[model samples]
Target: MASSAFSAAKIVGLTGAAWLSGTIAAISLISIPAVSRTLKEDNLSAAHAVKLWRNNFEAGFALAPPIALATASSLASCGWAARNLRTSGVKDGRLFWVAAALTVSIVPYTIIFMKSTNDKLLRYAKKEKLTTSESQETEGLLKRWVFLNSVRSLLPLAGALLTSIVVLA
Candidate 1:
């Protein structure tokens, strides 16, 4: 039963990490660029688009903590199991720890780098009217947000890669 649980945890961890990496990639590569173009056309359109995007982002963000926790928990479990079994050949425990650390780092990264821009965008999206300066500022913020968000994506991708290597090894 414990073995089965460990296996399930590993599967869930890998799945969550992969899903997060893909989602971040899509947002960075596809969604942000597409939305940025749309945002440039008109303020009303930009407001609506941002609102929709924020809603989607919030939904995804809400799920991230649980997924990250699960991934970290699973990696820790694998390490513990390996150590208990005296698996001398499995140096992958360090890889698991690295992956878990990366997974856990996402929260602080988001808070430190992404939160201010996200808050500003959300506030701007709520406005009934946007002046030219406001629109330009929004555009600037969006560009910065996209760049920072791309950086954010890399953390999970690295975590996923590390986790994959550990699992496969």
Candidate 2:
């Protein structure tokens, strides 16, 4: 059935997108702090710091496209799901199960922010003790990662909902 195809495709697409985004977030958790510490450890002049920062920005930009693709898939999935839901007499069980799966998938995206959030809250823990240059750099890197990751998660969900509205109309 065409409707069933749409539902199945949506689930598949969302699953793929969630996994892809989660993987990227995991990698960033590992890499952001390392890169930040490395940058600070160089102890370069201000000009060199500027250069390094620019390079890092460029690298992040380069990584953005695949992330975009992952999000796009979610958007598409949302549209598919919404379209399927528009029809009357659909089984509530199917819809409920899909919703449950989506809710579960969201856990990782939410928790991925935990480290950055914890770091922010724990700033008090280290306030009395002066953090090293490397520590400060790591914090900065973690901040950027959080910002980007937040954007990554929010935008896709927005796009998906937008698509659903547009398509369902």
Question: Which one is best on TM-score?
Answer: 1
Candidate 2 collision pairs: none
Clashing pairs in 1: none
TM-score of 2: 0.39
Compose the digit string of candidate 1's lDDT tens values, residues 1-169.
2666656666666777777767776776888777777766553465666676677578768877777777777777766665544433455467767777787677899899889888988887788766667766876877888788778777767878887776677
**Could you give candidate 2's per-residue lDDT for residues 1-169 as a string of tens digits?**
3666655655554454455455445445655445455646765333333344445434544654555454454444554455456562332323333433333343454457544553443442334333456445545545565566555544334433433334344
- lDDT of predicted model 2: 0.46
Model 1, position 16: C-alpha lDDT score: 71
Per-model TM-score, in order, reads: 0.85, 0.39
Q: In candidate 2, where is summed lDDT lowest over 10 consecutive residues? A: 88-97
**Clash statistics: count for each candidate:** 0, 0
Model 1 bad stretches (over 4 Å):
41-44, 86-92
